[model samples]
Target: MVAVVVELLALQVPENGYGSINDAKVLAFGEMGFGIFGSFLVLTLFFKPLVCQQPNTDESFVFEFLQKMGLNPPKDYGFSGSFCSWRGVFCDDKGENVVGLEASGLGLSGVIPDTTIGKLIKLETLDLSSNRITALPSDFWSLGSIKKLNLSHNQITGSLSSNIGNFGRLESLDLSFNNFSGSIPEAVSSLSSLQALNLSHNGFESAIPTGIAQCRSLVAVDLSENSLNGSLPNGFGAALSQLKFLSLAGNEILGRASDFTGMKSIIYLNISGNQFKGSVVEVFEGPLEVIDLSRNQFQGHIAQVNFSSTFKWSNLLYLDLCENELSGEFFTDLIHAQNLKHLNLAYNRFTKQRFLQVDMLTNLEYLNLSGTNLIGEIPSNVSSLVSLRTLDLSENHLSNRIPPVLAKNLKVLDLSCNNLTGDIPLMLIGELHGMESFNFSYNNLSFCASQFSRETLEAAFIGSVNSCPIAANPDFFKRRAPKHRGLEIALVLTISMVCLLVGLLFLAFRCRRETRMWVVKQNSFREEQTISGPFSFQTDSTTWVADVKQATSVPVVIFEKPLLNFTFADLLSATSHFDRGTLLAEGRFGPVYGGLLPGGIHVAVKVLVHGSTMTDQEAARELEYLGRIKHPNLVPLTGYCLAGEQRIAIYDYMENGNLQNLLYDLPLGVQTTEDWSNDTWEDENNGIQNEATLVSWVRGLVRRNQALLAIDPKIRGTGPDAQMIEALKIGYLCTAETPSKRPSMQQVVGLLKDLEQITL
Candidate 1:
């Protein structure tokens, strides 16, 4: 083109016909240059818009498409605006073309529109995951420039057409959790650029596609949860040398571990929940990070595998070979897997291996060897696992004592169905301060020490034959029992002893000590009364005695002050003669009932049944500490009623129920039937009075009534303080998990104060 222009200029110079040809050439050349410039300008004007149109208008199309797909763009973002500025969309500086689209969880339903998508010729990536869209249009394959495609967790159906093999630039393809069925087309082998393929959780049937092995660039293949049957294709491992994460779980692929030989880079392999049989030792090589060959019929002693020497699974964090027939010394090779965090060898016949060692696994957190026929006592060395949280040794032949040290830092301990005997150790109770669930059922445990003895422990061992003595030795029982068997003889001896001791020196000594203590207590009471002035004792002593009598078979005493005491009849009357209708709440501690005293005060009485080794003095201290502390949100303890073996504490009644009832109430769409008729009302009408209930109820009520009702009267005219309500919401949140997750009373107060200031 430059040469043509130069030739035209030379011709123009000659046509000028001047005496000085050089000057004529200059003038003609300048004119020719202007003409060429004009032509170029015209061409640009015709083609620039046609090829690279205004980015604003193109972006508007993208925005409209996303909105049509139910994606709400983030604030201040749109087409014509930088594509990179839009939510879930990315583009180059020119912003003239769409480069990427990652619209996930948008509730998008229906097929992707072809018109808008076809125009995005420059698109390099597209991810429309977790939507309701079904079926990718054939035109989608026209975007040959795409490198990544994710259409997971959608209702997308139908098989991948052969046209997908034409995407020469594609690297990653995720079509998981879809309804795509039928054999993977052989043409998929032509995608030389494919690096990762996730066809998991689909309906893909028929034999393992041999064509998949042709993709030499494949690094990860997840064909899990499918019906892909028949042995894996021959040389499948050799074909994809770089494969890392291969999961064929929940499939029908029948093969031995030897079938996975050539895949040396494989780090995560889960061929579990299938019919894959034979010794797992065949697949035991490489630097595996996670291996789950569970729920298979892999036979042979685990010792035969030689895992420690062959496979340096030092990086392995999760190892699950449960429900297999692999027997032999357990945890023998596990010492090398110091990094293992989750180990499950449950439901295996590990009979001869009486005890498994885990002291070396300092990082181990979850260890499950349940139903493994393990015998002998749990080793004391388990105390080394300071990071351990869950330990399941249930359904084993483990006899003798449970290690006291193992309870420390342990959260969930299941020793159920074991042959463990002897008294539950006191150190175990102390160590389990953070325990959430402690199951010792079907064990020969005589007693559990601590405050749990009277409630949780007693109830758990209700039908057991062994009598758990209060004291440590049988000699204590013999000394406490009556010496004579005859009733008349015992009565005569008792009368003779009383007559003989009436004027004895022992009686005088006892009187002197009693008088001294009485005087000291009297003085202390007077001093306290003077300092605080006269305060009314709202609860009646007589009511406490009467309620205690009806609640238990033994006699009881009620104390007006910390030092004063009265008899059993006072408790029964306070709780309306132990009426079942007065029951307030029941938990691991026992049942709490509503009580009205003669002084016209209402109290909540917690009655603990007798059986545990916890002493009455310990219960008193706990209740006392709870009573002295004051918090508006916390229920307050009043006093305690103690019987011969029964223990009860009193607290203020909370008219509104606990937080559990409020949040866990049945939500919309829960199935209802005649069998569950009685639970329906309780489930539906879960305390709607409190702020937590009000917020949850408001959300649900909006769906039910389709509108907000009058603002809850509790905060009416308070302008619906969003901040305060959200702060109060934390109280409800903390109670979501176990008592441990529930924040300390101090934290609860602080959170409430902060949330109280948020603007709506």
Candidate 2:
């Protein structure tokens, strides 16, 4: 029977097929092969379980994807069993397909390769955020099943593609803190299911797409810190009824506070740092928990609004209306906002009033009413708010002694620039060590320095009278004794004049070396230096500098007028020894004082604050740069004096006063007398024009391709016309309606550098 089967197999094969078999077994090979195949087929059918296992398509695709991404799969993802067991990998109930990947903050880099991640057709949630990914693969947009996509905090660039519309099921999309530019694609509105969309901290420009109003399902939308402009789209607030948290801050969106009336569910609304103006009452119509309308032009009083009908005041946890044009009495109804933790109403033109009736807001932790024209005594009722941690009542006309019963939990206290008088409370003095910031400067308050450390005294009282009784201040007798002792003062004055003449003669030759050496030492010192007193030979006048920091043995180094030699003694006498009466302004860096030198030269001395991290070399370099540069509009850096840790820069005093006074000191709609008397204030040569008009003029010229016409005639032929036009275009960009739309100073420099022959 075998021989018969072999003859049949041989007959089925080609004639040449037998040559490839062993020559010795050529005749019987067909019979043996037929028997072996039949036996093996029968065995495999019965024992299939003994065969080796291989992964399914989903597992193989996941392995390949991870391999291509150069990612090390979690430890549990061994070369056996299912990938569903791996960390950050989610699978369906069947464990057959990948459904989600929470691979955020992984060391993922470069482009997401094509056909790798997209191959996971069942993927729903993918979080690749906080990576170094620069671009997406071509097939990435094909992940139609994705419900949540988070690629935030990455290096992703370029416009978000219209192809993103393919994510029909996406519920949350976070691409914030990326370099994505260009207008937000209108196709983003196609994601009908998207509930949370965050595209903040990007370079996105142009008005927000009107189609975004269609995303009625959006619950939270944060488009802050982008170049978005124009008005809110029609039906934006009304259509997105489900929206609760919306932060369009740091943009230039123009609209009234009333525009948000339809967002009935808005619990957290922050439209700060925008160009939004007009009355602010309607913004409280929603049951809001947090409301930040700061840095806008919102005006009008809140007294007329019925807080009871507007919303649940108890639900309001945070409220910031700072830097607006709002006026009238403080919101007495705010007492009803018992849950409010923070309240900032600073820098507004409110009418003079008594201390805030905030004793009811016991939960208030932060309160700032600075620069609000507040008057009367700070009510002791404030002490009832035991949770209050920070309180700023500076730049107001408040009078009388600080309440002894201020909140014990208060960590920050600023009562500067007030008429507060009387002795400092022992309670506050005892709590000095625990306070983070305590300023009572420019006040009539007196405090005993016996218990307080020199650091505490200097830090707390810069411009205080400090006229404690002899029992409180041991030096009180010594300071007052100078007035009665005429002969002692005369001898001191004589010696000071002689020493001043000698020091003047000495500094005239080596002033440069002395200035540089003193500056270096001032910058190098790590410890705080306080100006305890002036030179022994100098006058006894107590100036603002006396309370500042310890004095150093260095002369005032005049940069522009090197020959105008003056010792540190001269600076003391020039500004009445840094008297608080001569105090001009409390600047961000420090304080500025107006003084007159011996040569009838009026100068403004700015004192750089202590505890700066800036290196000595950097400080020196900055000073040198400022001294070398001269601009017609800028105050010339006349000189500088280093007194230990304190760095003082002197500039030619402007009789016209600082910018704050020029802009805000007068009443609204009132022009400066100079504006009427001097037509030169409006002269185009001085680059003075209505800011809006100038922007419009330049924009028109640029739009018509005649930007060169707006350029200064002197610099017209200096640089290439193309470069000039490009530079003008950048200037136009800087004057954008919103700060977010404006290029950063760094970006502007980079753009200018890209242009040939363009000078900044």
Candidate 3:
């Protein structure tokens, strides 16, 4: 059935924004209807041409399965096209048999159908992950030839039956992130060719199946976050020699260090959060890349030699020994694990020592030694961690100003709660233009608050730093934000200076055409040319594409004298060259990014998206016009930048997010009188707001009559309900479609005041 879809998706936006529906596609249709005489002639002239779907016997099963799933037409979808063309359905080499089917993460709900799925014996892979499916079809086990089956991240319950052995060819079977409980099935050991088994984050109880050792092909095993207890079977480790990744963390499994052995191929091992006691000596086999023994009862001093002997762990990259009862001095020369990049020894009782062995971990990117009891002058050579990105020495007794050269390329530096002393380093902060997070809280440090610009403080986590002298200064946040007039004056002076300089330069010799064009480019900022679509330029331009694939060379114009003279390059550098991590929000126009200008000024950069309808000149004009509207509550348009098709407007960043999001959070919709709910209201008071406990009585009760004034849940059903309704009435009147229905600002203000008084 050909039905029209009346979906009014575009909402009431501004005239410049709300798309024009008048530009509908001009479609013309031509249909030929056969007359009674023409039909007689066609019958005599020729036989009807054959028109039907190319037949495929194997596709019938899959087509029926999709029809049962009710996913075809969203409402009445049937296999109208070839079965191979269905979403998430894949065919074989000859395109005759459906081999793969995956509808994971598509919000599919309900249980699966057995008859249709059972007929698809040729299906090699089936993935229904991240759905609300609660159970599988009984006949689903008949797909014995399937190689991979994943029903993970669903609500699937019930124990896996011994019939799991039917899939003897299964290489990977993932049923994780579900409500499946009960003991591990012994039939799982029948799959001798199984490579990966993930039963983590489930309610699986009892011990690890001793029969699992029969799965000699198991290369990865994650049984963490379960209630599996008791010691592992004696031969479990020996049988998993080919295992590369093993996670038994977040369980009650108990085992001694000696009981685990002969897993040389294991690259990632996590036995943390278990009852794994005994010394860590000769524990891990050689060539382990990661070892996490944190939060366990591994007492006594670490042998140290096992983790730090040169040539011992040639491929070790991560080692975490935090939150354990182990106490000992760290190996001074950690050259044994030369490839180690992450080391955490926090919350341990290790004694103080000079940990300034800079040459040890030249490849280390993360080093956390918080509360490990290291004391003395900060390592002078600590600056040699050329690859270090994060260094957290918080909660230690180390006393000193932060090492200037330390973590030069660092993005996160945590030195809070230490015995640091002296003035905050301005040069260090200045050089740390790329720093994303810095913490110096609860320390003996003082500094002029103005030095830490808005961006710097924003970069610092809440309560990150302790006291700063400038924070108490009344003028700390009163720093000047360059005004629009300031840019105007600067533009004038720049043009005059360039003209004088060019005059002197042109007097030298015959100037080329490039030189003359360069002069036009210099004065082109004032020339509002409507260049459309994506363009590229360097140094300065009127508009640049919002999708900044490469570093932009556009000039950054400041509205006023900002704290620091930040250029486009500096902004790009602060935001990892405008990486996705820096993206704050995507709006109708373009995406907004958070950037740290020099002096730590946190600013929000709203890059306007350029479409075919809008040009560089129009965008520039729109931004300039919007920037001129200054009000008390308005977010200040701090500056603007243009390069090719990219037009960005920088504003004083509001930490709580922008206004557009707040409006969306309300989700205002028309609520007519007839559709009002008739149910008892429940206030925040803990009393029984409803009078009836019986279901019959509760069904008959009706809610109090109140207008549905959409407001944030934070203020919903509270005293603001009345106020919201009043304000919304005024808003609706102002945004009324008819000019005569719209009210003036004076009348709107009067109505709002009356509403306020009435509410009070």
Candidate 4:
């Protein structure tokens, strides 16, 4: 080897004298050893095409933008080619790219293919919500390392593009119920990492966009029902100071309810049916857990809204201001709403308020004041509403009695048209055990010494007075004298006067239990008669009277007759032993009793429960077309008792009960318009009392038509036939809202036979 390279250049001849081999330091040590082997062969051919241009360390780019939003990688997916083994892809751990995709409800439809989302330029998070995506391709906001965009309930329409604020790392934008209309974008208030914006029910109209107070990390804003009109944006409660759920319900927004007292970090505030008026007092401060200012036009006195501090509603739970015009003294600001659980102030005007200390709402479950103008009396401690399930003081103006502690755990009690008298109140038939529903129709209360059970007084009762003269009373031979006690007392008063003269020669076997009256001749039959009472049935001339003292407290005389052909075993034997002492009231449509029939008259029964085959065929076709119509403000049908499956109907029995126990039970200051005026019954019956003075005289004919001062004596009136009380106000307008507008019983017997020929 040339003498071993001449002894290795004489053992590298610079060993002893450092200056010799310095030819430019051996040409800089052979050009630094060929520049370290040509920089390791040009870094292995310049990183071998960047290690073959990366990618498969488990192919990611958010598994190609979740295979372009269609979310792939499932077949035997053990994906070591790691988008962390794909499947809703979420990478990171050297396998590079793709941060997260979420892929909710993934039945993903078309249109997200921008070369698998521009290879997810290191995407951070993109959740394709609900998915069936309609459009979104504008390079889909170039991702800009997106931070959370959920296109909710998609049908995604046009409008939203202010370059969608280029999603400057969007924090949470749901775009709710999508069909998005215009007027929201001001570049979505530069999203400063929007906290949670759900543009509800989209089609958003004017107002509301003060650029949404520039987001400022808003915490939840659901612009409800949209058509959003003006008022609300005065820095909308300090620009959403971390708001916690604010729903501007059914917007039309007419301001001034102090503009909702500065939102105070609202905890679910629903500006209900907005048209909001003044004096909503304290307008909320905080702690509210759900406040729906229903139907708004809010007038004063829900105790001037100062809800007894604790930030006004210390974690309140649902307080809906039903049909507002709110009046005062509702159980002292509704027992200060102690965490109330739904208390709808229905049709307000709350008069003479005395819910006799509503057991201070121990978490009341729902109490609606139906058609309110409330008068006192239901106070048997209202059975302390042990979480009452629903008790609507129907048509208020309450009365006395019928408060057998409200049938224990009443399920739905609606004391219809009240005035509530004696008789029918036998501790409401041994505490109605968890009653299901009950409504004492057009009351004056008299089921003639109640004692229910004939399958619970044929399911309860309806209308058509004195159950056919108490079933043509011979009084079952006076109850066979308690089954013949020593057969004496002059042979039981001569065998009950020879069984009441053989029950008046079978008075046609008691004319199927008499008392049926329907005398409408015509008066345009008063707006298709629905049912209040007084009698009518096209009367040219017809009089059937058997006065056993007017048939022992008659009332329960509804007779236009159709009640679904007829069944429930004919209302369990005409009320004979439906005698749980003949219960009396418990409402909503469940129990009301006092049936005597077999000729002793006095009937009032109503019972409705049995699960539901579509609400028992719509309450047996609305009580068989309201018992085959017949009017006089229509509350007739004085006959019906079926039994077996149970369904009883028989009305007529009102000695004044229900019109809410006579506006809450009379007594208090007792002036009720000078003790129920019509000139105090035209100075005690001289003018022969005419107008309908009950329900406290129609609340003094609607407080003398709003001139106020009608005070209360069961509405001191003796003048009603105003065309049969305006055709019984069309059964309160057929219970309003759906149910096909209600006037059917043959249009309520031709409008109560034209309101008895226009009240004759």
Candidate 5:
């Protein structure tokens, strides 16, 4: 666009109009550039009056829906001018009709206004992603002309309808990161025109529909991060001849490694985090550039490729098989993967004697072989990987002197917990100009008298160590405080003693402190128990967590006082010191992290947001009270830690997370009779208050023998309808407008137990 603008500017100037170009000519050219740029921007902006094309229908419904949803766009975005000129609305080339609407990430919530969009017959693309969109109008999918539809990262729910196949010209559909559940609708699989289909990060279950073979033109497909189980339908892989990217990771896809021999066009494939039970060798040769088969149960061996004939190893950029049980030879075909930039074979049973000639991978940027049982001396030619940016050989059995060449261009190096033994290579340590992270801990290597540089010591260590100069040893623990001048020490001691005396006298004369203790009298004997700990959750310091860390490992304050005396060290170990990858979700309060505590107790650690309204003590008391409230659906607060202003709460991590995320995503944009009655009043003329109103109407309609509103139609017939209706009744009653009218816990529990008998 800038180039186009520059071209236009160049054409607009009159060559040699000013016979001699000078300072004034240059200033005039600069002024003309700004004028031309402004004119171009104005031309691109939609203006209804430009072609005297006013909207034929009332589009005020969008604003009214936004207002009802308690959302208001910027002040400039409203009905003050032509509706066509409003933000996110794009007009056609003739400037006579709205062709596109991209009002995503504006914090808008609630169901899409049907009246507003139903009139946009010419709309070819619509994006309402990354908002709080809760529902969709009945005919939301009626925009048949829409080729690109993105309603991802929202709170939409309900089953996808077969009617979607009617969008024969649609090219891209992204409904990822929402709460939409149920299997991928067969109609979606039949969309031959679709180029990209992303249904990842939803609650979709069941197997990949066999009907997917009908989407012959699909180039990319992402159905990851769902509850989908069962093997992929046969002939599904063979049908996607044009597929360039395919991801079904983070699901329960059970099968042997899928046969992709028919997929000659395959470029990027990821089937990681599934239940595929077979050898990693099942992968077929292809023109692939990236492949990830990590975090699975594939074992035994991998395919030994004849890279020179069967495949182009130079085309492969990334190959990961980490966290699997695959063993046997590290194929020499890897030597042919000279163009590979990233490779991970960590946490596997690759018990190779030594990775010889690994330096042949000169183009490698990242390599991870940790926990791969690599024995013997380090690869002699390891330095040949000159392009290596990050290297991990930790948890190995390698024993050799530090390779000086490997340290030259490396930004990150990890050789921790290895069996290497020798004096530190002084020259190698001195040549690391780009070293950002370097760890040689837990090795048999001796420390040199020269000692490591200050920069190197500042880097973090991954494992326990004894020889490293920076590692904490007996000497470090026994180090004493430096002596002070005799007169200064005497003066400080005298003042401290005087203050102590004054405080003791004041407390004795003016204060009356109470102590609470639990005494157990048994066999004519008594035992006194009282918790006497340091008391100062009182200060309003911002750096409390840091201060607590400086004083102790962790300040864990139990709520119900479990028998296990867990400490900060426990949490640090459980979450790898709250590693970034363990973070589950971030809310206004703070980040919630997933942690695997000792004994396999999965927990969620919520580090409270700083500068919150609650004080340190008040937060503790509230947390303790909250810990007492337990329910099957509610996550129970296990404990809390308060250090100054820092507050951290612990809870049992729920597998499926919250109800809002489980029940609905922002906007599935589904239009079907299965989820709604035939007489449903989705038209704006009908009075619709909120989502609760829809649920209530459905409840009443179900009572009338109308179709039962279902979020998943596949579950219908496969399960008892009575239980489904019963569950719907419970949900509707719980959302009653009058809180007091809702059923009590005892009634709800009884109702649930009664309905459990009708399960499939």
Candidate 6:
């Protein structure tokens, strides 16, 4: 019988580690007592039920509970076998009485009806947490045998009932993360056997009930993130000597540190985000593993505080004292805490020390000392801490170069807003690729162009200088100021004025030459027109126009000039009866021809040929959708026409021709000299190749770490060098030799946007 009862308890207990070890031990002892009594009751009742084959009273109660709560019973064992066969249901040794039911996270909803679960007099453990249950029946408080009740993470509302004190044998009660409001009932002091109470993340307000001190068996209490105000109850901590975990964080509580002195067994204490003010030294007297006193008004000197715990090896693992008024030598008192893994002392006013002695705490994993006003070089021995992963020393006055060797296990390092100078080490640059975060911005440090690429350097270090001038030029410090300073300044000014005058004259001369060339070309075109005779179109008969109108009756739809009312006849007349002389260009989608309408509005007409797959109606609909698209960079589709097999689209003519012609067709006698587009290299087979495409040439330069050479001469002095380098990197990725490796157009646009942000 004992074995069967133990198995039932094991199955019902949550697998998730919910409470501290001390809470578990106390709850375990109480549940064991319930199991023994249940076994005895079954043995005494078994002898009286052998002769009769009557229905079980416990099974009937469980069935009523499932039905009223809209919970489904198992298909195979639906009222046919013992209720123990159902999932999350447990029965006593005789299988005649239901004792445990775990229906957590089942998405159960609606209010439970009265007289359903209340009839299970033998039920000891009931867990219906993580559901949508809104309310409980009035009779639920009558379950005297329930040792543990968990209804957390639900939408249950209304103030807790005073009748909750009827659970005299309840050992653990968790109603946290619900919408329960109003002052906690004073009748909760009646649960003398209760060990753990979690009422956090709710709307419970007002001062804590002083009557809670009567429950000396309390082990863990989490009342954080609520609006509970006022000071702690008298002797609140002195009475709960067995408490292991106590958290009142994110509340409006105000109390001295001495109120919590008697918690000898406390392991984790978090009272941060409150108005508590006092010396924190008294709160450090426990076998603590975690202590968070941050965001409070505590003031103390670190040398006077005791860093030792009750354990021999120092069980303290995390300590946060940031944003307080604490002062003194920060690390001197922390040497005894060898097991400390996380320490945050930022935003304090510690005395400025020339050298920090934190190398002794080699087990540290996370450390933050920003805004503490420390002024000195970071000690080189900090690299010895092999377990260090995150370190923050920003907003300080520390000067000198960074230590060459940092712990390779570092994943986050922030040293921004400091006076650190000199070139960043190449080793640090190599390690940046794997780090999650690294910031050296707002410092005097410089990065080498040869070692750092814009792709590898994250934006966290954006404000650092891009070029390492001292390293590139060995004689940078050797140059001295001239003794004749005034004479040197006068000489430089005169030379600059002369250069400026000469440049203006050269620009004017080139402008004059280009104008003369345009006039000569215009005269030659006129001479050619005269030799070919006057151009004229034959309009001998209007029968051809009538035939065109008969072939296609639909009028041309114009977007800009809607009143033009052009037809297929008017288009044919403007294009000189579709003569080849009016042809402007030929493409895959038929030919484009230039035309002048009757009102002297110049337009370009494109003939679309989609074959027989697209009907004329479908083609007209598609053209209508295309005509609505309007962008400043795109030519507007002015009108469209459908004439039997051909689909005509008319657009506003551009005086500058197509993009390819405007870009490549330079004026005559102009030479491409020093522009970024003039990229040429000598190949072994071909002496000097200027015909190499821009993408291929830039790719070679990027591979050799000379991406800066591809920057346009005109833009080099106009924008930041880092933005140019990043732009080149994007170009290199877009022009990868492997077609599949190249980035899509969408990704390319995103990269360009990032470059623009850098420029800003």
Strongest candidate by lDDT: 2
lDDT by residue for model 5 over 1-760, one digit each (tens)? 5556545534543331111111112224465577665655554343222222223443444444555555543334442355567777777777656788787887878877666665567888988889998887767667778899999999988877677887777999999998888878888765779999999999998988888888899999999999999987787668888898999899999877655546778899899999777765546467889989998888876645333254678788999989888887687778878889999999887766576457568888999988788888776477777788888998788887765456357888888768787766656556544577677766656653224444344232222232545443445556445674677789999999999999999766532221111111112111110010011011112234445554343456556656566776677677766665576654446557788877787889887765246854356547866886756767889888664456789987888665534333222346554433235336566554333465656644433344355435778776788788767666655554434335556556656776887665
* Model 3 Cα shift for residue 49 (angstroms): 14
Tell me each candidate's TM-score: 0.53, 0.60, 0.54, 0.25, 0.57, 0.54
Overall lDDT per candidate, in order of appearance:
0.66, 0.74, 0.65, 0.58, 0.67, 0.72
Instruction: Give one digit per residue, the lDDT tens place, for model 3 in 428-457.
Output: 666555786777666666654455666455
Tens-place lDDT per residue, model 4, 266-323, is 7887888878886665556676688788887888776645542546653677878787
The segments of candidate 5 whose C-alpha lies over 4 angstroms from its true place after superposition are 1-87, 303-309, 427-436, 448-760
Candidate 2 vs candidate 5: the TM-score winner is: 2
Collision pairs in model 6 = none
In terms of lDDT, which candidate is stronger, 5 or 6? 6
Q: How close is candidate 3 to the true structure, as a TM-score?
A: 0.54
Model 3 Cα shift for residue 297 (angstroms): 1.4
Which consecutive 10 residues in model 5 have the weakest lDDT in total? Answer: 527-536
Q: Which residue runs of candidate 6 sit more than 4 Å off their true CA positions?
A: 1-56, 67-81, 305-313, 354-356, 448-458, 468-760
lDDT of 1 by residue, 474-577 (tens): 54456533555577677989999988987587778855543332110011121111111111111223333443434443323233353333334556777666
Please give, for residues 1-760, the per-residue lDDT of candidate 6 as tens digits.
Answer: 4775545534434332111121222234465687676664464344222212233366556565665566554232343333467677888898877799887877678897777678788899999999889999988988999999999999999898989899999999999999998888888889999999999999998888887888899999999888889988899889899999999988889898888989889998999888888788878777888999988888878766764455433677899989888887674656767888998988876888655566677889998888788798988888888999999998788999998988778999989777899977778877877888888876778876444455344335545676756656555456557788788889999999999999999988855553332110111121111111111111122332334445334567787666787778678877876665776654446556789977898999876645335765456546756776767899888888876556789989887677544443443336665343445455656532664666666765655457788887888868788788777776666554434334557556655766676753
The TM-score of candidate 4 is: 0.25
Sorted by lDDT (best first), the order is 2, 6, 5, 1, 3, 4
